[model samples]
Target: MISAISGSVAQSFRPPAISLAARGTESVQPKGSDSGKSSRLGALTEEQKKQVEQLKKTDREVRAHEQAHKNAGGQFTGSASFGYTVGPDGRRYAVSGEVPIDVAPVEGDPAATVSKMTIVASAALAPAKPSGQDRKVAALATSIRTEAQAELAAKSRDKLSGKDESDSKSSALSAQAAYTTGSSPEKGSQIAGSLLDLFS
Candidate 1:
């Protein structure tokens, strides 16, 4: 029921490279040292250049944060991942069977609870008219969130309250805070930010 691939093969599975122009990189311009290494910008305006540069900047910033997370021991949970991937045709998609929320819940932590509900909120917020990843994520998120809210509402105040609890319960409560709108990762899609929204 499980399959694995080697790290080298996995590393090779990268997205298409961005052109220098697309990445908004500068040319090497030293005094009397034009060694023919230059970006090929064919007719793109200054505004276009700036826009491409901004996109590159955002891409790098996001990746750096991601690396920092991993460096600090952040790992993917049942609710995290690209719900859909972009294809050669430049279209976005996720196969029908691979929805992130469908992954089995990681039990015993409040962070797991928040991860579940955060995904539910995102899925609920996806476009209603579109019949695609947006629709799927939104729909799934809504369903999960609905189920969770009902479940949470049924718990006694003593259970949900934090006056005094075990370490596991307290940590879980802290992790669950991400779904409450004020948490760092919950403010945007860093943790549950829409995949579709990222490219947009």
Candidate 2:
């Protein structure tokens, strides 16, 4: 007896579906809608708004320096300083400036990859003194700083370790190039062995 598979069974091994939601889309709101107003309720106040605008200017300058330092493979060192107060309306405000830092790569290897990033935040406060409402503001700032440092430190370690895979590939490429350039078979084997040992 002979058995045959149906076309539908063969077609069952088709490619998986693709989702297009990953691409961004522009949303259009209908006329006379209240959705837009509610969306902006948490924005900074007039005084805070002015302060944030000033912060943007400082941020641009710091970013420029940070980028230069990163390109040169150096360490990034910067500080954010601020003086702030709270108003009777329960809003805390402050003026702050961030000094840009130099970023450098790890020492020893000239071709070592390095990455540094910095952002400067500056602002001025309308009421520049501590109050009950300001207490919460201080706490919030402290929380943000702590969490941000922790996150950055973790992410940095992850990024550095992830480079190991790429470095192994680079070593393999170097060994292949050396072999193709008339190096002895023994030397090429040694190079490849060293490359494999890197991740080991």
Which candidate number maximizes TM-score? 2
Clashes of 1: 5
Tens-digit per-residue lDDT, 1-200, candidate 2? 00111222211111123121111112223344565534543455788556555655544543443333233322222233222323222222332222222222224322221121111111101123322322332343334445556666777788988898889999899879877887766876899999999979
For each candidate, what TM-score against the reference? Answer: 0.27, 0.27
Which runs in model 1 stand beyond 4 Å of their true positions?
1-103, 108-115, 123-131, 154-200
**lDDT of the structure predicted as candidate 2:** 0.36
Error of 1 at 196 (Å): 71
What is residue 170's positional error in candidate 2, in angstroms? 1.0
* Residue 185 local lDDT, model 2: 65
